[model samples]
Target: MNSDPNNQNNFEHSEYFDKENIHHKMEPVTAAFIALIGIFIFYQVGGAILTILIFGFNFENADINAMRLLTMGGQILLMLLPTLIFARFVYPHHITQILRAKLPQAKEVGIFIVGLILLLPLLQSFMILQNNLLEQISSTFPLLKQLMNLLDQMDKLLEKTYSSLLKSHSFFEGSFVVFLTAVVPAICE
Candidate 1:
């Protein structure tokens, strides 16, 4: 057999380790905890800070399109970028596998489309039912009256904001909203 250490033929005969990969450098649980902390810090807390910096304390007067753009930026920069960099450090050799960096087959895509189409109505109905149940429970439990009132106030504010975000005046705007609301989350998640 050839004796060159770097040769492919010697792989079976010799134990090889890629020193560049941090696969054995950290415990899996430690790595996962670090990842969670990183996500929370950069995406959750940082996104909130960034929003406050740009939009001030009140979210009421923020422009809808700009808010949508900021949300997309947070997904890409604060969330996706850091996850990618961390994966590169800890899983350089298996980066693609770590990130699921592969296109699905057409059949898989079709099945996902069909599943989403069927699930949409069920999801909407569940949301409506949840709201109705919340109303009934709040009345049955007087202690929950204040909590329900708070929710009702916030719900009205949120509904107006979400309605503006979801509305589109033209086809291009609708496509952008779809990318912002759907495609970005699908990829980032």
Candidate 2:
């Protein structure tokens, strides 16, 4: 193992109990609460902005299919931007510490790649299961149905934005254009 400044001295001393070396030692419950709040705020603000940009600006009664495509493009950006920002700035230390801990291990890298490949199918399965579960719950519970309705409203807002955009350009072109807009800011940042 290579000697890392963050972990080497502690390993030498065998003082594994030391909390100082741990990155972000806040309680899991506290972190979960914060994450929920963050999700709520991000969805409300990001969803609103995406809807306005995609749907509100391109006010017309033309091609519905085109508008659908643009709304999808907007939704993708809305979902991705928050996650990228958090990873790059708000939680950069976590990524650095993880990389340092794992540091250039061929076996670890191989395992990680294999795990990621496996996870793709698992994630799709999970999404399918989540949708089915939500459907069942909505049928059984009024509150679940209400929550689903709220989600539907958000989806409609996103779709309206997409439809507006599609009216102007092909779906691929619109997505590529929006992606370029995002990339410029990312590069500058």
Candidate 3:
């Protein structure tokens, strides 16, 4: 058995430093707890700060329309910044190791594409069925009807500008708006 420092006991050191199998490297429960705390703090405190900054601590029914745009931009940045910072600083090593896994095979990618193509129509059909069921239930259930009324009240609280922004659309136009709202945010994020 060669006892030279460089040649001896390669397996022993390899076991200690191996990075390929990241699933084995479990995150501590404490870390998860801290991450949750961080998220809560980020959201609550960040939202409060933004509200105060934009609206100047108004308790009454203050007109907030001018602040609404700034609020949206600030809220988005606040939400994403904490998560990004935590992931980068607190667990960079673990994240990088996990992301080093092999890329999806061509067949897997093709199957995923086919699955999505099939899924869209099925999802839309499911949603239509769900809406019909809700309508039927609301006819019988006063509570469900009241809930729908409450939702309508909430919608009315939004500005006419926002309501108009939402309502000025055909099906294709609505789909395009939804796609831009969802996909652009995801891509930018």
Candidate 4:
């Protein structure tokens, strides 16, 4: 054994826990590209899952409640998986730091809720303007019109899915649906 203070132990001088001095094997640009690719692939996979579950099963041929459940699963995959992968894999060491995951103060939470409520109208206005602009552009361009039509159909499908999900006869059923659709996703994200 070495008789020097620097040679006290192999683990003591190791760079693994020395995060400040750590040099990641993956470059920032490479990590970003990986994240983007992961997001794109996961989104497509989620969409494919939704399509197979929804159209393949033929929701109209079965119970709408079942269709709603399938849609909820798809939504979970779409919203959660990519986020988790990007957080854990792309930035493994700094997951919480990257996500800014921390418990906010009550005042901060209240402010955030109030800010969101105030901003809703502005967001809606922006969406309305965007839709109007797209419509105007679609009218002038044939390809754009087709794209817009496709988007419109998708929107209608989403509305129908939401309706199916929200159509609850009992208070307990409604509460469960709200918790599933809103609370769970909010917590996951």
- Best of the candidates, TM-score: 4
Q: What does candidate 1 score on TM?
A: 0.64
lDDT of 3 by residue, 69-140 (tens): 444455466655665565666555555543233445689899999999999999999989988898899999
TM-score against truth, every candidate: 0.64, 0.39, 0.46, 0.66
Q: By the TM-score metric, which is better: model 3 or model 4?
A: 4
Q: Indicate whether candidate 1 or candidate 2 has the larger lDDT.
A: 1
* Candidate 2 residue spans exceeding 4 A from truth: 1-114, 156-178, 181-189
Q: List the residue pairs that clash in candidate 2.
A: 54-161, 55-161, 66-166, 67-162, 67-163, 67-164, 68-163, 70-162, 71-162
How does model 2 score by TM-score?
0.39
What TM-score does prediction 4 earn? 0.66
Error of 3 at 15 (Å): 16
Give one digit per residue, the lDDT tens place, for model 1 in 88-137.
77776766544534456689899999999999999999999998998899
| Predicted structure 4: lDDT | 0.70
Which segments of candidate 1 are over 4 A away from where they belong? 1-42, 121-129, 170-172
List per-prediction Cα lDDT, in the order shown. Answer: 0.80, 0.59, 0.60, 0.70
lDDT of 2 at 68: 50
Candidate 2 lDDT over 3-94, as tens digits, reads 46676355534443333564554564675576467755766687557656665654456356545544454445554455455544433455
Model 3 lowest lDDT segment of ten: 17-26
Candidate 1's error at 24, in angstroms? 5.3
* RMSD (Å) of each candidate, 1 decimal: 6.8, 8.7, 9.8, 8.2
